[model samples]
Target chain A: MNVVEVTNICKTYPAFFLNRVSFSLEGGKITGFIGRNGAGKTTTIKSMLNLVHTDSGEIAYFGMPLIGHETEIKQRIGYSTGTISWYPRKTIHEIVDVTKTFYTHWDEEAYRRYMTLFNLDESKKPIELSEGMKVKFNLLLALSHGAEVLILDEPTSGLDPFSRDELLELFTTLKEHGVTILFSTHITSDLERCADNIIYISHGEIRAACSKDEFMENYGQPGDTLEEIFLRQEREERK
Target chain B: MNALLKKEMRLSAMLLTYLFIGFGLMALLPGYPILCGVFFITLGIYQSFQNAREANDILYSTLLPVAKRDVVKGKYQFVILIELCGFTVMAMMTILRMTILADSPVYRQNVLMNANPFFLGMVLLIFGLFNVIFLGGFFKTAYSIGKPFLIYIFAAFLTIGLAETLHHIPGLSALNAFGFDHIVLQISLFLCGILIYAALTWLSYRKACTDFDKIDL
Candidate 1:
């Protein structure tokens, strides 16, 4: 069963439009939503979550339309963006307290574990945290709610190599527990490491959707990586 | 909806605290009840818009597990909660003044002003206008707080000035002179204020929710 299915989603802006974007993520799998900046990855993600109103199309989560089932679907799915800005004056404890009230399956123990694991001080205000800490705090919020599907935008954009590796490890652990993850990131290395499926978006339209192994089999030699295939595809599209 | 309201309240704690302090200070001044009404109307408009901007509230709220409509509803609920708090505090101070400070100069000055239903109704109408214009203008451009705030400031001053003038006109002056002593007039004025407030509350919410639904964020 697919966890999420987006079909024919379109949104028009003065500078760009997400034209007929469509894709599906299988249940219990990690899918890397890959694209360059201004390539409509974020727009597609926003439309899927109903954060951005689309001109036309449908988005389904767990086999139901997203419009009417937003609250239910959101309760099951966790979303984290690159810049997670809330009330800066609020303490971590206050933020967590407020956020946990929204979910029925919120795991208090899980919240505590992640807070401890990240060395997050509950008493500290959000503004006192570093950019990396802020991302981790967002991740902690996403994970603590017992969310079945995690949708992240640019999750690894500002982290160091060690933290990036840690995040990938966390993704692997989440996949083991049958939690589906759809993360968009510019860093191809992270996707290559754990993504079972890949969806490439370019210029507000989907260019490719296939398993990483299948992509490698078709476009790569024995040693050519995901980056090379992406570069090749970019070059071909420009022709 | 409760979850969103809870979060919004926490986000607005600082503003609420400031409003409380302002109310407390007003309690000591002559004609404090009239000041209370103006203070809440101005502060409600100013703080709601200011807090939303400073907190980057739209982005934060949209990311939450809430429907767009619920977010709008939660905001209205927050404003109503603040107004309730303001009214309660002002009423309590009024009662205390009447009972304990009957001979006090400040109490004597404000006693005839806000004690009447007509004055209360006028205050309600002014507050209603503020809500209608501010919330209606806000959801049109979710991020543009300045335009709405400026518009409300201009509207509020014009309204209070007009109301003051109308209160002194010979025909309306009879009603003001009768004041709270005339039970029938008081009840009628109170009912009128309440009806206007309720109608504007409904209109503002409907308009804000409609405007918010169309926002792309």
Candidate 2:
């Protein structure tokens, strides 16, 4: 069963347009949503989450429409953006205190565990944290709630290598626990490491969506890395 | 809804603090009532403009487990709460000042300036118009605040200016004096202001929900 099913979603901006994009994520699988800058990756993700209104399309979670079931769907799906700027003056503890009120299934013990694991300072406000720390805090909030599907947009953009690896491992553990993930990033190495599926988008259109093994088989030669495949795809698309 | 309101309160607590201080100061001035009213409405508009500039509310609230409509509802509730608090604070401070100056007719004269029901009604009308225009323009796109903020400010100043000028005219001044004498007329005008406030609150919420739903974050 698919965790998320997006069908023919279209959104138009003055300078860009996402034209009839469609993709589906299988349950308990990690799908890498790949696109370069100016490639409508964020727009597509935001559309799926209904953060952005689409011009035309249907998005569903667990076979229910996103429009009518937005509150329910969002409750079960945790989302994190690349830039994590909440109330600048709010401390981490205050933020968590306020945030936990929205979710009926909030796990305070899991929240404390993630805070300790991430070494987040509860007394510090968001503005006091470095970009990487902010990202970690956001990830903690996302994980604290019993979210079944995590829609993370560039969740590791600013993390150190060790922390990034730790987060990647955490994603694997989540998958093992039957939680699906739709990870968006331009970093191909992260995708190569753990993604079971890849959804490539370019110029506001979906270029390809398939399993990582099939992606590598179709595009890679012996000793060719995921980065090489991404570069080759970029070069091919330019032509 | 409670969750959203809690977040908004936390986010805007500093603004509310500043407003409380500003209103407290306004009540001590000789031109207390009208200036207090002006400050009250301006504070609301200014804080909303500031929120739009920050854009953090949109970022955080949209990520939460609430519908777009609830966000709008929560925002309207927040604004109304702030306005009511401002009104209460200013009213209390003004009344306290009035009590302190009971021995001085000159001070009482100053207190009576713009203290009539017609003037109070105009203040309410200005606030109601500001909300209708501001929230209507704001939620239409929910992106840029400059255009909407400027549009509402222009309308607000012009309306307030015209209302004040109209109040000074000979015929209206007579009506104002008449309203000041008759308790029933004064009560009726105050009730009219309340009615407009209630209608605008509902209208603003409805408009905000509609406009917010169409917004692309």
Candidate 3:
């Protein structure tokens, strides 16, 4: 079953337009949503989650539209836009404790597991954490609610090599547990590490959307790395 | 709804509660516009917006397991809750002044707004305008706070100046009446103030919720 399906979503700004963007995340698989910074990856993700209002679209989780089911859908879908900018003065324990109150199926076990794995200090405020720790904390909040699907935007952008590898490994582990993930990033190497599927976007349009092997096979020479395929595709678009 | 409001209070409005508590005592001042007390209370509430913006609260909150409208509802509820708490303290002080200090020269000879039903009425009016002007302006963009609040400040002081002078106008001296001097009229105006505050605030809450619904966050 598709965990999330975004169909014909569109948004427009004074300078940019996301044209009829559409994709879906298969249940329990990691789909890397890849694009350059301004190629509408964040805009598309936000549109999917209704964080960015769509000019026209239908977004469904478990086949229900987002408009009326925001609370229930959000409870089941973990979303981290790769930033923890709220409650800078409050402790992690304080923010997470309060956040858990909003979810019906909060998993204490998951919370503790991430807390231990990330080596997070609950007493420390967000300002006190390293950039890596803040991202881990953002993921912890997303996962603590027993979310069936996790949509992370640029989850590894600011990480050290070791931390990035750790997160990619965790994404693989999460996939094995049947947690569907849509991981958005420009970091192709991180995607190469674990993503089973690829959704390539360029110039605010989808360039490639397929299984990882098929995406490589269809878009570029068979042995090309994901980064090579992306550069080639972007070069073609600029032609 | 309870969860959202709780979060707003615990995280968003934490330190600001002391502002509400302390400013209500501004009602006890012997000779001040006293309406300016209401302005300061509104300013205190404005500080919550500053903190929320700095923390990017609207972004985090939209991701929570609550409807987006509920987020706005939570904010409005918390703001009104703080206002009500301050109003309660102000009311207690007003009652004490109306009774114990009824004939005290310190209050009687005071040349500014008195703590009375009429004063309380204007307080509600100022609060009502805060909701309409500030909150209504805020959710239109969901991020900009300065211009809207500046507009509110202007409206607030204008209302304050008008309120202070109303009692001095011919046949309107009853507005500044001392110790039940015009108890019936004062009480009626106070009731009208209550109705106006409730109506205006509820309308502003609805408008804020609507504006927030269209925001991209």
Output the number of the TM-score-best candidate.
Answer: 3
What is candidate 1's lDDT per residue for A198-217, written digit by digit as tens?
Answer: 99999999988888898788
Tell me the lDDT of model 1 at B163. Answer: 57
List A-chain TM-scores for all predictions: 0.96, 0.97, 0.97
**Candidate 3 chain A weakest ten by summed lDDT:** A79-88
Q: Kindly list the per-residue Cα lDDT of model 3 for residues A93-132, writing each as its tens digit.
A: 8898889998899999989999999999899999888787
Instruction: List the TM values for chain B, per candidate.
Output: 0.81, 0.79, 0.96
- DockQ (C-alpha) of model 2? 0.62
Off by over 4 Å in 3: none
> Tens-digit lDDT track for model 2 on B59-91?
678778898888877767776766666555555
Compare the candidates by DockQ and give the number of the best one.
Answer: 3
Q: Is candidate 1 or candidate 3 better by lDDT?
A: 3
Return the DockQ of model 3.
0.79
The superposed Cα distance between candidate 3 and the true structure at residue A7, in angstroms, equals: 1.1
Residue lDDT tens for model 2, A1-239: 89789999999899999999999999999999998898989999888889888989999999999999999988898988658577777788888888899998999899989999999989999889888888888888899999999999999898888988998999999999999999999888998899999998999999889999998889789789888988898899999
Alpha-carbon shift of residue B138 in model 3 (angstroms) = 0.7
Interface RMSD of candidate 1, in Å, is 1.6
Judged by DockQ cut-offs, the docking class of candidate 2 is: medium
Q: What are the runs in model 2 whose C-alpha is more than 4 Å off?
A: B16-18, B21-28, B31-33, B48-52, B93-104, B107-112, B174-180
TM-score of each: 0.92, 0.91, 0.98
Better of 2 and 3 by TM-score: 3
